[model samples]
Target: MAGEITETGELYSPYVGLVYMFNLIVGTGALTMPKAFATAGWLVSLVLLVFLGFMSFVTTTFVMEAMAAANAQLRWKRMETHKEEDDDDDDSSTASDSDILTPDSYERAEKQPILSVQRRTSPNLFEITDRVEMGQMASMFFNKVGVNLFYFCIIIYLYGDLAIYASAVPFSLMQVTCSTTDNDSCGVETDAKYNDTDLCWGPLRRVDAYHIYLAIFTLLLGPFTFFDVQKTKYLQILTSLMRWIAFAIMIVLALVRIGKGHGEGHPPLADPSGLRNLLGVCVYSFMCQHSLPSLVTPVSSKRYLTRLVFLDYVLILAFYGLLSFTAIFCFRGDSLMDMYTLNFARCDVVGLAAVRLFLGLFPVFTISTNFPIIAVTLRNNWKTLFHREGGTYPWVVDRVVFPTITLVPPVLVAFCTHDLESLVGITGAYAGTGIQFVIPAFLVYHCRKDTQVTFGYGTVNKHRSPFHHTFWVGFVLLWAFSCFFFVTANIVLSETKL
Candidate 1:
């Protein structure tokens, strides 16, 4: 299976791929969801979350199918090149013989090559053997304007992501470290609000502490963007383990608080006005579509790919429900922090000092691991956007300029405001809409047409989406438009109220 796939990474079982997808989808967005749930009311949040999860799953399948199509298109072009070379050579037979299809590790190993001159159609050609990133797919399927729009949307989305990370880590650190109460008495709830003007260390203010931590964070993680750095397998495993433990601890503590008679929350049944932010939260929470190629391409078997995706979504939805439901029942909506982990620290929910400390610092640990990775990704995208054909970048420009541009803007944004809820909402509602909804719809639609033109309508893509009809593509686009309108109206009304 490793030999069959063309990616540089090692192949893994589908189950392992599922785990990667799960970790990718559940991140800072999930941490903020409880607050969004609390504000929107439990019923509204649950309904929107389930529907958005389904919508996200539909687009995920679109991306996977488009990946298979991209692979087929690459194979088809290579086959054409091989045919052209064969025609020019007197020993064309030798050339053709050397290019014969060998048995792959997939279930279709026994099948003949779809690109053969004798047979220009085979399902094997469409098998997702190559790891094609979403940007590359945009270049393949979209025209000049479309490609530029795609890059613009994704760049904006990544900027918002970096900003969220930039603020979240420091905010968590500031809250955890600046608390004046002793460990024994920290569990008692107080009406005191720790605003920016409040003193943390003698004359130092809480806002000043946040800035100091943010600076420290940048100094530590910012350098990685200048060089190529990837999250190694072991690092991924360690961070994922920590994430699970953190989430589990929060859930259990919330349940314990609710199980006792001390539950302080009595949320409304529904709140239509909060639906806008809730939509963004849910969309952001289910954001694995952008990273699906990296996760899905190396799977050893994809015969049941759609089924596996469905199962993953179901589990994610259930887990999210459990987490948010416990939280809303255990604490007041007004008291829930943007970072849910912080709620446990200030309340009587957890009497243990170590547990509270761990919950408070959890975001700092988990987010720090991802910040460098996202920063590098955004830097590379900037280079790609401005790249010219056969042109080379100078060492200083390539190394220094790009990373600086990527890092500075987000840090400046974080400096102005650490309002993570608004940041996540706006990011997910706008740019995330393009990445999660618009691009996949167009990619699958255009890729389907291209596949039919090259391989004929008879060639079937084994990994094609369950919602393969032309109407599904239009449906996704319509939903994207509706989301835009709905979110825009919500923002306007919110401002009017203010």
Candidate 2:
């Protein structure tokens, strides 16, 4: 029983776990969704958003089940090792077969139900206690090629995340700081459209300002890659507060505008052409599956875990609907900015200068808080990918090379294009598909098989997904493939048209 348990981290109530999950899923993607919603039309966006949210929920359950199974496997291995040590110490002629059942023996025992496992305490073999990251799960459930592919997909996704953050922070600053007018306050109602070439500060153009801010951003936050980022409780609370205030302000402002009949938006009922990007945005918006193990495993009690997660998804879906629907109604689809907050900065939409400034700089505040953590994550993942067992890296290579590789590519990508919409879309569509859909499907499928072989079919995983049937796993995989093909075809056709 002692060998069967492993410490994860500071445990919390399921409600706190739900809040953490909600925060993780609703990040930069939510900010980009309003524009995508406007482009795709309300009806299509609504239908697809609901469907994608459900699918995300399904896969989330898959990850939870897999986590439980992984814990069972780890616990069983540790128990076996402990039993082996005991056997060596005693060298008993009558070793208890029930205590150390191997896979083959477990199969035989399944046929012979008369046998019973004796223990001081009969603990649930499949209870989820340890936090197994998606990377660890990948290694456990996937073949060598699949493991490498998982890392590759995750690395690419993180790179996209960093690039989006990089471009977004500077882009937000550029929008707020650059002006066609001579006034320092920069008339929010100015009719003149400024581009990269437009002068911001005398000799400095808007593009130059963006680059300057990007460099400043790198200098300010990029060094955390060389160190570690341990986000404390206060930091989490502060960021969560900023996020809620920003979201509440945006939603309220949009509603107020529409309520007053000052709304300029009239989105189409259906736009098949925009569905491509909408799918990506929705997928990206509901992405919490990759980090589920870290979030879910720390829950002190999981008696109502399924219910809690379902409730979280329901709240999230409603929140997303409110945010996007109001945006599409209050702002013209053609005029919707990539980052939805930028739309609020317009004096026409939001009259208050303070609110406009806060909204404009909101991405800067939130994204800066996340940049270091993500950069360090990417750096560690790089080190992990190339890492060999029993081998040690030199200080320069371990400290300098990994961080440099992690920090540079994303910044370079940001320099090339600051298209937040496309970055989120491509990242979510391709890599997010792998993480959110394909990986969970396979992980659950493989873990279930392994659990049956190792723990016998009679052992019940208390944390098993509601969608425990094999059919559900197959369905998820099929949905993933269909989305991938459809998105690829759409991208190709769109490119050809261009």
Candidate 3:
């Protein structure tokens, strides 16, 4: 199986792949968590985030197991077909020899060479050597409806990610540019209490300034979706560096403030109403299942894939706990901002002018690098979803329509509301729920069933989950539906009260 499928495109080491997975999972979702934590109360937020992280880890392993099974199935089928073709050629040559063959028939038989699978032993049924993307595996193992559902779920999740990126970058620009500190940092932010409705320069209100910034942002980045972009290794490194420095500063600053006996927030133990949004934010923060193939495939050694993933999740959980816990305790509940960095823009929060500038503009720099890449990703997904086996689209449909569809709806949503917490929460709870929870569960169940039927129950995949019991699949489904019901009921109840 290893020979048949060329899986040796090991471009990076296993540890590098682990870092890639960690970066992918810990993006914009982390930026929106502090506000949600303040709303839900610190104790409730901690419990919910820990549980959701565990749930997400479980589904992640399910995806890894399914990937292995898909590869094994591919290997077995290729070998079977090769054997049948060999048998056909040998039988045909024998039949011609038995009969009175013409010169033409003999020449044809001489030209034909027999390829025999008998020369090779049966493929290793447990070997996982190739990259099988989730969509391809879905089509391979799922019913028609399930395949369509998988695509739909993934598309919605990608749209949600794009929307978050779109809104966050512009909102950060608006905050940092308009609200400067009164030190070596900058001028006064007008009235310190003036809301997002305040004017920026002349007649342009902050909302209007946000719209202008959004327009400029769209013009700069949106066109990239129409064409293809290449590797962004340098961009990734810069953004990652900025991300770590900014987050570390915020956490350290908050802890120092608490030690000085100036902590203003004293949240209750738990708040049931806020739990709905907290669960969504945590699930969103832990999502990397959709991109698992690209992250896992290029590793030189995959034997320790599980260990690497487990360690990454543990670090991410600890980071989220520290960051949010510090934010909620350092600032008043009402003072927490949707974009966490805004909480530090004021000199009072962090007296250093340089630190305030860095923290305030962090989202603009980091999310800016990501926005174009995600736009292109969403555009490519559109092409794949509509692609036919032997057919092609016109240049206009291929370039314009797909990119437009990818770039517009999200920008429009962001324009309507730069409220990052609500945007992240809603998107996470619904589309994130499907991708992070329900889809992976269904994928593993179907992959396992297909493996049993094709390779018999005696065959065990090398990468099957540690919690490989059938019961885990059912539990994932049940928990996802329960969250869905609770979120829906909460939204309805809030609307009724309004």
Candidate 4:
């Protein structure tokens, strides 16, 4: 089956696409950022976040440029296929979906998409209308081993994202419902690192309550993986609205506390000890490269596409700075929670049951919506990876087994531990790095070479990145490796620090 395609005439305005991109990048990562900022020192966090955001933007362009090249190549083959089919009388012959256009695939030119798709594949390299997802591009440029590596990194990243959602929703539910009244419950004054053995309802331990909630979350969202789940336009709007309201409330409340001269944070200018976690958190917050094809393909206009993306990043950086800075200063550095919204549940910051209720359940509403979708995507990826052309699967294996595997590992992960910070940190440190920096860098570099070979050196790709140089590509790769080493060292040193 074809991947989700944003059709040509149904494209969104460039500005509208900005909102979607913004929404995509600023997800659960934002919720976990304030703690990292507070711990790392506001000044240090600010510089790191800004730099990371810029790096993510650089990679975003890299992915977009590669996408356009892919589109151009597809269009070229469609043109060639058009000529061959015209010369033959077999109008019923169709291209095999597995046939990807490359130097090797040239001999089997009959198995390429024909010019019937030309309207969707525009002549202007910048105005690529076909929905060439990242997976397709990886196959187009990379050899078998390279493609497998790409999928592995992506699968790991998706699992990390799912695990976060699985754990976060239950953890949030436990905190909110258990915090109020009921002495048998793990009540309001439980320690920051409350354990599973603590008192919950009746004979239930704190961990029992968390696991119970996780089970409930799994039952509710996990089954959606058995089928397909697409977030409708209405669902997107609602999620976006809730996000804006929750974030706006958080920033405003922090500013209010700061304005009253009640700010408690007095962080150092920089802390070498906290930089590693801070880097991971900031990298997670600025992520969007993986979802770029879905975001960029639908945009109707090409003019100022890069500028619009830069502006969106600027806005996001400002938002994160405003949110994290306000949070660090308004709340004491040491007192900040991993899930920042929980801090407002205190009597001092916010007293209204409505505000606390809304903020407290924010993750439940948002992450719940996303969990099943990611699960389904991972399940689909599994099928794609192991799939053979002209092969089929038993119904039980396709429907029951794939979803079961996808659902179990992450839920079991949440069952074992609910440390959102460690989950996000590890996820961002490794898979997140690959998605944001390494994959995009490699994809663009190899894509540039492929484009030249396929279209000849003289064919200028109009949509190539402004940072279209070998040095930029090398810089991105070096930076990715440096980050990998830093995170590895941090993990080892952290283990020793204990």
> After best superposition, candidate 3 residue 321: deviation in angstroms?
0.7
After superposition, candidate 1 runs with Cα above 4 Å error = 1-6, 91-120, 181-192
Give the runs in model 4 whose Cα sits over 4 Å from its true position.
Answer: 1-9, 89-123, 180-197
lDDT of each: 0.85, 0.84, 0.79, 0.81
Model 4 lDDT per residue over 1-498, tens place: 123334643577888889889999999999889888877887888888988999998999999999988887787778568656653654443576323333334543335433333223334854568888889999998999888888898889989999999999988888876643534222353236555576768888777888889988888888898999887879888988999999999999989999999788777788888877788888888888888888888787767899999999999999999898898888777777778887777666776768877888898998888887898899998888878889998999999988888888888888888888778988898899999999999999988777655544545566778898889999999999999999999889989999
Worst 10 residues of 1 by lDDT: 102-111
lDDT of 1 by residue, 1-498 (tens): 243545537888888778778888988899999989999999989998998899999999999999999998898668666655655764435544544432231113223223442254666988898899999999998999999998898899999999999999998888777756545327322222557887777899889999999999999999998999888879988888999999999998888888887788888889987788888888888888889888998898888889988999999999999999998898888888888988888545677778888888999998999999999999999999999999999999999999999999999999999888888988998889889999999999998877765555556788889999989999999999999999999899889999
TM-score of each: 0.92, 0.92, 0.88, 0.90
| Clashing residue pair totals per candidate (backbone < 3 A) | 0, 0, 0, 1
User: How should the candidates be ordered by TM-score, best one leading?
Assistant: 2, 1, 4, 3
The RMSD of every model to the true structure, in order and in angstroms, is: 4.9, 3.7, 6.7, 5.9
Question: What's model 3's lDDT at 239?
Answer: 86
Give candidate 2 regions above 4 Å deviation. Answer: 1-6, 93-123, 181-194
Better of 1 and 3 by TM-score: 1
Q: What is the Å distance of residue 416 in model 4 from its true position?
A: 1.4
